[model samples]
Target: MSRAWMSGRLFGAGVIGAAVVGAGLIVPGSALAATTCAAPPGAPAELTRVQDAEACGSTTDGTGGAWSLGAGGVGFADAVDGATVAAAGFDGGAGAGESRAGRLLAVGYGADSLALGMLDEPGIAVIVTGPASQAFVGDADDPVLCEGNLAAAFNLTAGSGCVLAGAFRYVTPSPL
Candidate 1:
């Protein structure tokens, strides 16, 4: 279970989704039905160790809403209600207080839902639109984001679907 393995899992899921789509199987909008904004259901207990976790759910009409569970350090703003959930840190720590607009994008019915977890420099981000979703992890500056659905584990250092190398942020220590 390595970061590379996690990335591979994400990619594989995406391929499966694509294949299904190509076969004329329409993923119903209901598939993205709303749920309480929280860590994905059946998530591992280790997720509690994450310093922060953010989650959002998409409504039946395609509108999205978000909430958080943890230190309350991370905040979310909907760039496009029901389509995009933007995240920011309260105190402007590493990867905080910045717009990820250019780096993140979701179109059609998939823009309104997302989930994220941060522990120090390592983290994971997920965006859900109906049955289609995407997951990302690693360096906040240059993360490896992919489209698909899968259970993510934040506690494992390099487990499958875990954060990758260079995903950790290296903050400079302040002088005493």
Candidate 2:
């Protein structure tokens, strides 16, 4: 696997990308060599707390079918354990086209167990436009997005999809 790695923003993984599509969250473009996967460096400063448990978001599929769903979570991970994928539309089954804000769900190492956290954010646009098997995560099992670069860097990793996703440290309380 020959993955392209720039520098600086190689960290964590989100919920959407290449093969898996991050639960079901569609990007709105095709896949290719994404050169914009690196997002600045640090997480946002103005972080917000998730008021409710429901995820609010809108999605437009390839067929142009726009849909919305609340309380979108199927197999969401527990923040108490570790960082989890908080993505919308990623949650498959039932509602079909919706999921919890896997992008906004992140648990710190300890203490603030249920509070939202900020990790090194990756470029969703990159994963969205990069590969079908790539997505982003906040900091799951020691970073998945950046892990791709490492694996691909050493030609030791291969997946049908990759992710450049991560929960925003600066959440807006609810999904859009």
RMSD of each: 16.2, 16.7
- Identify the runs in model 2 with alpha carbons over 4 angstroms from their true place: 1-54, 57-86, 89-118, 121-136, 139-142, 145-176
Report the C-alpha lDDT of model 1 over 1-176, residue by residue, as the tens digit.
89987886686556335433532232233223321233222221111123324222221112332232212222333222222233322121111111122121121122222334322333223321222333334334333343334212121222223321223422222224
Q: What is the C-alpha local distance difference test score of each model?
A: 0.28, 0.22
TM-score of every candidate relative to the true structure: 0.21, 0.20
| Candidate 1 wrongly placed segments (more than 4 Å) | 1-62, 70-72, 79-81, 84-163, 166-176
How do the residues 7-99 of candidate 2 rate in per-residue lDDT, one tens digit apiece? Answer: 212332322222244323432232121111111113311111222333323232221222222222211221111212222222221111111
Deviation of model 1 at 128, angstroms: 15
**In angstroms, how far off is 111's CA in candidate 2?**
26
